[model samples]
Target: MLTIWGRINSHNVKKVVWLGEEMGLAYDRRDVGGPFGMDEAYRTLNPNALIPTIEDDGFVLWESNSILRYLAASHGGEAFYPADAQRRASVERWMDWGFSWADAIRPIFFQLVRTEADKRDAALIERSVARAADLSAILDDVLGRQEWLSGDAFGIGDIPVAAYANTWFQLPVERPSRPNFERWYAALQDRAPFRDVVMIPLS
Candidate 1:
């Protein structure tokens, strides 16, 4: 059995858990980060003390997006990861974009949603909101033409972006009217895997 170490509320962890559910892969999850507290054993598995570290058949892996790619390739094969070179590259670009956007917007999200109203950094949140909106518009345009990020079929590309999108939509900030983004998000909401794993209360 595979063991996942991370708190359920974590976006990175949620991505992995969501992938497992999507692939119908049964796995055990252990809480170790956030309020759960990390120990030496957990550190051994992920030296960075990150929230999502997985042990699959004695092979430990860290990095949330990397883990998602690995699981999709190992379990769902071409369906989730894709075999076509152009399709795979297109999906890979979205995955990479997700990480970059996360780094750009996460600090603002942390300050705005995760922190108390009294402790929130208004200036930082304002800047982050603008940046996040700009970034989201780019995604909105891409999703405008297709049902999924990578052409007509859903694949690994959707996972990482959707994880962050959940956070964006859940936040109190005002969002632009992006019909395409909304349509795509609505479809994801209908999925049991996404609802069960990614659609949790924001912490």
Candidate 2:
């Protein structure tokens, strides 16, 4: 059985948990960050003290995207992860892009969702939101041509990107008109794993 460490509300943790559910893999998840509080023992697994560390048998792993790739490859999720070199590289690129997107949008996310209203940085949030919209436009253009970020089918590439997208829409900021991106997101909403796990209220 796989053992995972992290709180469910975390976007990164939600990515892992949702992917696990998508793969139909049985696993145990232990809450370990964001008020759950990591102990000294947890440090041995991840020096960064980040949410979402996974142990598959004796193999311990951190970094949410890496864990998603590993599980997809190790399990029979090659349909999502892909076996072809070009296809796999495409998925990897989107996963990496998703991480970069998260970095760009996180400041806005923290400002609106995590911080108290009076304490929020309006200027910073405004700038970050602009940047986020610019970034989202790139996804919108790509999604306009394809059904999934990984290509024609839903796959590993969608997980990390969608995880952040979930938060972006849930935030109380004004979003641009992105019909393609909205369509893609609507499809993701129909997935059981996404609905039950990734689509939760942002904390």
Which candidate number would show the highest lDDT if scored against the true structure? 2
Candidate 2 lDDT over 1-203, as tens digits, reads 99999999998999999989988999999999988899999999899999899999899999998899899989845686788999899888999999878987899888887899899888999898898899999999999999999899999899999999998888888999999999999999999999999888878
* 181: Cα error in model 1, Å: 0.9
Which model scores highest in TM-score?
2
Which residue pairs in candidate 1 have backbone atoms (N, alpha carbon, C) closer than 3 angstroms, thus clashing?
Answer: none
lDDT (C-alpha) at residue 15 in model 2: 91
Minimal lDDT window, size 10, model 2? 75-84
Q: Write the per-residue lDDT of candidate 1 for residues 1-203, one digit (tens) a residue.
A: 98999999888899899989888898999998889999999998899988899999999999998898889888888889888888889998998899877875697778976788899888888888888888888888998878898678877899888998988888878888888998999999989999888888887
Q: After superposing candidate 2 on the true structure, give the runs of residues whose Cα lies further than 4 Å from its correct spot.
A: none
Query: How high a TM-score does candidate 2 get?
Result: 0.97
Report the C-alpha displacement of residue 10, candidate 1, in angstroms.
0.7
